[model samples]
Target: MLNEEKSTEAVSFDTEMSVEKAKDAKKTLKRLIKLLFNQKQKIIIVLFFAVVSLVFTMTAPLIFSKAINVIYEGIKNVSLSGVFNIKFDVIKELSLLLIAIYLLSSLSNFIQQHVMAAVAQTLVLNIRKDISEKLSRIPLKYYDTHKKGEILSKISNDLEKVSDTLQSGMMQFITAVLTIIGSVILMFSINWILTLIAFLTIILGVAATSIIGKKSIKYFTNRQESLGRFNGQIEEYFTGQMIIKTFNMEEEATKTVETSNSKLYSDEKKAQFITFAINPLIRLMNQIGYVLVAALGAIFVIQGRLSIGLIQAFFQYVDQASEPLTEAAYILNSLQAAIASLERVFEILDEEEETPDAANYKTISNPKGNISFEDVKFGYGKELILTGIDLEVKAGQKVAIVGPTGAGKTTLINLLMRFYELNGGKIKIDGIDITKLKRGHLRSLFGMVLQDSWLFDGSIKDNISYSREASTTSEAHQAAKLASADYFIRTLPHGYDTVINDENSSISQGQKQLLCIARAILANPCILILDEATSSVDTRTELEIQNAMDNLMRGRTSFIIAHRLSTIKNADKILVMDKGNIVEQGSHDELLAKNGLYSDIYNSQFARSITAKAL
Candidate 1:
């Protein structure tokens, strides 16, 4: 994907840019809510606990007020020169009730938190599953056009944001709304004046939160975008570390990272500053409301218009209500950020998947490997890479394609493998149009060994048997021995069980090529594809690999993309491609006799080899 970079920009721009509009906020929110509703059982449990918790919490203040009133009345009577007596039983009962209320409140709160935790984790788990499944269905062009870092960022970073919101922020939002409602009712029951004063804070908080939230949407969106760009640079730069170091471009690479990093910092700062500004401003308004309520409460108590106990209860209500009011701003910001994240995640989900495999599709097993390309025309983008190409191959025929870079050598193999659909014309295998065949069935007919030699982090045995898992261990061992990989495997730490990865230097380039050849050998497909399979190895190793490839290709139709003309000298047929069309076709010697492009490339390579041998 980094190889597709064409612009002189500091780093490649994400194709997803400009799609994260504030307008999608509504749709994202609705979709998220719909996802939550899907977990109705858990949500119901959470809601039940929340109600119970709120009930217990609201009861505590009333009980405390009663106890305070009892004590105050007793003190007043005693101060009036009466015998000092207190309702000790009532005080005891009230104390016990308050303790029970608080304990129950805590229990309910714990239950709700526990249930919501499950809801949040489960929701994220399912979304990840959807994301994973969606990735498999999308066309290869998406990967070729889009930056890998951005793809990874959406999967990891954006999901984390959504997860964080659902985990705590969601519950906080629900509880905040509930607590505000209950506290307001109780506040009004005590005194409308104090409730009104408290509401001044709410009004101010709402106005400030609404304004800040709208402004921060773009900031958060930009923050994620900037992070995505930075991630792209990191992914590309690190993956290309070998090239960078070989060319001594460390400074240039660092500059790329720094450029993207600086942009990320600038955007994140703005997003964070705006998101956090709401809390303090709202809290300050709350403090002012608190002062006004407290002063008025004191004056009312002195005038005997409101009891000390009731005013204290009113103050408690104010604190309870104001708490949510203060958090309203923060929660709004979290929701907005989460929505932004969801927007990006949904972009992946909403991508146009590869046209579905047709219903009642055909299957091919043990195909005769008769392949024909009829006026095949294709392109990655608007510009065609391959145009009006026609070819015919009989069963078990050996075909070699040769060309310089960008000459459509690899693209031909890609089209043959059905990695990309043809823009025009039809490709037929054994006289059946490939479009009618199931993709899995079509691909299973061929085995491929690329020059890069891909191997996942797994046992060597697994790597060899990757193409055909149904192959027996004995078969894998035989394949390894045939490809000349068995000797190397035995020399390793764990022999056949030795773990290897793409980056494992323990296996030399030639050895990795051998393992890949072994994999192709194990599959035993009706056709084979060799894409510069021996180009990276030394001449000695190249000879060994060529022998293994010869064995694999024997009696099987094969298409080989060769850079060294000498390697394909014995090829049954050679197809010379320039630009996108086949310019020449014949046996190696027959094509060289023409003294055209194929002859020129071969003579140049031959001259180079002769000179290197002389040196």
Candidate 2:
């Protein structure tokens, strides 16, 4: 249960960090959008279309009103000549003008929308590429603390929201504002009294939307976060499906998913309710404004203060004015969602990158691999794993490191590879500080084989030649034979052409180890580190592997970490470590003579193995 608490705590901490990083992503998106507008001619063209469309839409009502007034004047037998002079024939001409205006307005709208989408999509594509490149350059520690699902969600889900905002939201926002301003001006020109009534209703509608929008912001943010957690859980379940089934924890896993699903459903329903409420509330206010405008316009016509044509124009203008207000409300909702996604993506982009300051450093070309650690101190966080550790290995010498569990043997190798920096003292290779060499060049100098061998999904030939430098198929085959892997590989159905899925391959642990060794041998590094390389093999296989190890270690500086004492009996030097300190060091025979920690460990481990075999 304590372990469960620790795991939950770890999950919570990571989630919070990711959420904070997402918030920073918004700034990155905003900067990208700003850069798009740097092209002044393109921006001007889009704005010009928007303005023209709004102007043409506002003129439609006046044209219809004039046509009605012309008919009324002819029916009343009033002096239609020079009395508010608008020719009956001219009214027909004006109707045609109104049709032309609406047609132009529709064309302009289509062009502007297309331009906006093109600009937005281009910006989003650039952002996606930048994020992918940045993620590749980051250190492995970042991945250790992050989930694959959450990272995938940012690229797929969050990035899609940003795209939506660009393609539609931004252009709609601008168009809505322009539509409202143009319609309002025309409304006032028709009837000041009616315009006030329409304006008051719009203000009330906006106030309502603003209040509800604020509450919806919190819900939207929660919804996005819940989705990220849900994705992470799904990824974990699928990756560990075999373990869960073996343990018969299917019900427990289902419950975990249900809990997350329930939270997401509730949050989504709440957010949808609020967002849906916006359109209806605005429509209701527009209906009220419509009634008020018609009532006020009727009173003005009866009082002889306004023409019937003018009253008709006021009614039409009121409806047009309401459109922009409702559209503004919709834009606000979309902006909220876009902002939520942007914040998440920015979090990853903002993380501090691994130090890349090995620029003033020199390369270790053909490094002789004389390694020395002088008073080295290291730790993970606060727990010191290695203290005052001092050791040396000459070129072409094989040194073995043996220790009880938790004695920092692996940590020492990690320092040598520069996976983690030392907290104190210095390490040197061939009389040069390892820290003073480029990280890539320093790492290229060593070949490593660990107990757990990882193979990417590829052909056997491809896996053997994973290094950047090119090697022929013949060379790969030669290396595989040296590692004793060629015997089984040649017997496989496809031999070198067989494609291996990342999962569902049936290679034994020993075979996998040999493959890893073959991969390392193909690199031909001057230094070699073998960490429990033969721990997984059977007696017969171990003998074959030992011979391969001997060939690989020839004329190369080697560091062998092993628990099997017999394997290191022929080593030039054996260092016995315990509790972050080297308790004893000498040739294997000399250590046996001392009969201290090294001898006791060897006697106990090897004696038990021999006795078990006798039984």
Candidate 3:
């Protein structure tokens, strides 16, 4: 009972979100139709064949009625004889015509189906291409705000749904509508009273279906959202499985996933419950309509006003008319899922992209490694993280920034890369404001190797030479050698050609970081930034990497963010940051001489090491 109440509350909340999604669905559907319209020529041909098929199908009943009438005339004209026989010449001819029409209809159906399928596949291809382009253009903030699974759901799941709907549902809808309209008109030609009765039943069935559909569609939309959240959880949890196990959080993670799964299950059940009932309810209405048409036809025949053959034909028309109505209703109900999917996909497409650069942006031919920050202020939102910050770096200098976590060490790197726009002040390179230069051009002048090593699924050589497409194999080897990565890479079975799959679990984290260093080294940028580049490796590997980094940083202005005081002992200048401001700035020995914040931090780490050794 408690579960039931929780489900109700969840459903109610989901209903509101679903309603908003549904409102957008219509607009999204229109846009989808517009996309299909791009291949209007193929669609037009498909429509023509569909209509021709419907005409043959609709005319078959009239021909069948004619055959019945022909049989009646033949019986009436029969002469009394001991071996009396009746000729069915006219009936035979009509039967032959009906068979031919059915054969032609099948052929037309096949052609239309083939064309429509081709059109659907092409549309999906184009949409995927557009989505791929959209991903590259969307701002970094968009990625920060949205979960990876949600974006992927839009691309893969949502787009696939839209494609399925277009392939099958769209054509069914058009044909069903045409069948209904044509059946109604033909039924009227035979008997208006019976036609009216049939139409009333159709309207009642549609009304009931509409009521059910309205209730069900909300749940369907809710299910989509739940599924998205569930997928995101899976993606997050799977990627963080190591951390979860390390912390013994397996049970907690399972409970969290179960909660998400339960919500999805509830919504799916409610939605399916309502939607699945529509068909049976409509069938009930159709049965009632059949009874009325049959009973009424008998009375008309007995009154000598309606012929038996005509009544038979009218009965067939009633069946025909009601079927399309039922079909259209069901197709429309099913389209809700597709529409919900479309809404999500369109939401991504409609996200604001990164702003384009100024028409006449600055370009650097040969950037000197001179960087300065003048009164720079920044924050995630309202509270400034770095207020009234200033800094200056000369070419080919090694500058190390040491600070406690959340002291704006990484934020400075983010600002320098223009990953986020600053709230106040300016950062300049070679006396020119970085903001005046195009983002691509500005970023091209600097190279970064952060703590998190990003290596895509590719060969070792490919990963090493990612920054420079034109870099030769020799250049990649040289870069790897400089980063102390060449020997291990060469030891692999495929050497540089060994494929690094998505997980890259084949390579150690230290190796991955070394490859990243090699990549940055290959870029040959005027300025270099290393954010805890050696934090993940062992002492021995760190020494090797530190040596490689020293070589890489030569002839370039370098900024290093480090917590290990030993690593930065040789730094030309060490900036001791506290609470987002540089509290002290000088050479390492000078900072140690001050006996202030830097000394305290250095002593604390030394004490921790000695304490660990004693333990």
Query: TM-scores, in order shown?
Result: 0.95, 0.85, 0.92
Top candidate (TM-score): 1
Model 3 lDDT at residue 293 = 86
Q: What is the lDDT ranking, best to worst?
A: 1, 3, 2
- Judged by whole-model lDDT over C-alpha atoms, candidate 1 comes out at 0.86
Task: Indicate whether candidate 2 or candidate 3 has the larger TM-score.
Answer: 3
lDDT of 3 at 9: 16
Count of clashes, each model = 0, 5, 0
| Cα TM-score of candidate 1 | 0.95
Write the residue-wise lDDT of candidate 3 on 1-615 in tens digits. Answer: 001011121122221123353355567778988998999999999999999989987898888888777776667667766332445676678889999999998998888888898898899899888889998777665676567876787788878877887788778888888888888899999999988888899889878977876666677688888888888889989999999999999999999999989998998888777767778888898999889988998999889778888888888878787888777777887788888777777788898876677688888888888999999987665667678889999989999999887677877788888876788999999988888899889989988888888889889999989999999999999999988999999899999999995477789998998898999999999998888889888999889988888887888899998998889998988998877789999998898899999999999999999999999
Error of 1 at 288 (Å): 0.9
| Tens-digit lDDT track of model 1 for 96-195 | 9999889999999899998998999999899999989999888766787689999999999999999988888888888888988999999989889888
Which lDDT value does model 1 have at 452? 81
Cα lDDT of all candidates, in order?
Answer: 0.86, 0.80, 0.83
lDDT of 1 at 284: 89
